[model samples]
Target: MDKVQILRKISQIFFFIYFIFFTSFCLCFFGLIEKFILKGSFGSLVLKLVVIIVLTLLFGRVFCGWMCPFGFLMELSYKLRAKIYKLKKLPKVSEELHNKLIYFKYLVMILSLVLTYYLATYAFCKVCPIGFLTNLYGTVISLIILITFLIASFFLPMTFCRYFCPLGAFLSIFSIRPLFILKTNNNCVKCRLCEFKCPMQIKITENVNQKECIRCFECKSSCKKGGISFSIK
Candidate 1:
């Protein structure tokens, strides 16, 4: 791995540990939103949400790339699967299918919000895979949900983040036009290495400012030709 990828791995590990120690305060953004709706007021958790929104607006979804504990697990699972299969690179969904599937996250986000508001409960949290990780006492159904998603990640890589994570969907709203974005330069050979490396499977060459981009810089680091860079957009 390149320096940027190494740094990102270190950041993911550190934040995963931090998350374990502060699970209550570091609940996923969707869970926090559920809490705010159920209580009908803002709290410290909401303050954290505000901070996340600001950061996402400026830097894209850095939290997913660098901080999310569950995302870290998904990455690990993907790596493990590759190792077990002795594959140079895992297969990716077709671009047409990927485009269709990505919108599922947005639907999940809207459904979560609507359910939380109408049901007067933390409906999403009750089954959230991240919540399941933090709260081991969750129901058997939650355990099934967690295992299912983890297995999906092993096969598809970040399946939850790309297609089902309400938090990712919510963050995408602010990250679509973040201050900084990944861009390709004149040196690009269209090798498509960056796309293969992208955990979120973003088509960086086609659109660097895509909302699904996690700002991981994998594309930048993977480009041996120095074709990709993160810059002010």
Candidate 2:
């Protein structure tokens, strides 16, 4: 209801438009045109990859929070699951379990890198269900991708990003540095509102690294005590 929350909501909306609608649309259209009309060129593919990597470095995992089709799908699915199953009322996983699972993203990233190195392509992107959905053009493969997306959504909360999203994993390393992080002051009341607002289910108070944090500013907006602020160090 406050200005901060309003701004956060607006920012999220902008992210949805940029990442899901605009970027995905461009990538899908470009890929199709290159493969069919222009004939796939190695140069074009490499250029696209370079652009994505540069964006990641410049913005951290802002792409994950803002532009990733899978992230958007997960958020939408979370809302639906909350409505259908009343899951919003349920307590998040225990802190012990949550922290442990946080490492899963990094593990997935390493595995994905290995696979890409061996396969000479981003294997995860090649088979990403969300990416496939965004590019769906009537293919049996898309059907399989759809099924996978449904199953993941029904079972786990942001399961793809938590356990399988190699890009999320890739970003974790960059996020650990003392830069572009939400900092808290001593006035902190430990209200724990930030923890709840974090969609990644991170224990924001204890571990700031929180690989799952997308820098969405949800926690900063949620802090009623005005204890949280941004820092780049």
User: What tens digits encode model 1's per-residue C-alpha lDDT throughout 170-221?
Assistant: 9999888888877899999999888877878777778765588887787787
Instruction: State which candidate has the highest lDDT.
Output: 1
Name the candidate that leads on TM-score.
Answer: 1
In candidate 1, stretches whose alpha carbon ends up further than 4 angstroms from where it belongs are none
Q: Candidate 2 — which pairs collide?
A: 19-67
Candidate 2 whole-model C-alpha lDDT, 0 to 1: 0.60
Q: What is the Cα-based TM-score of model 1?
A: 0.93
**Consecutive 10-residue window with the lowest summed lDDT within model 1:** 130-139
Return the TM-score for each candidate structure.
0.93, 0.70
- Each candidate: RMSD: 1.7, 5.3
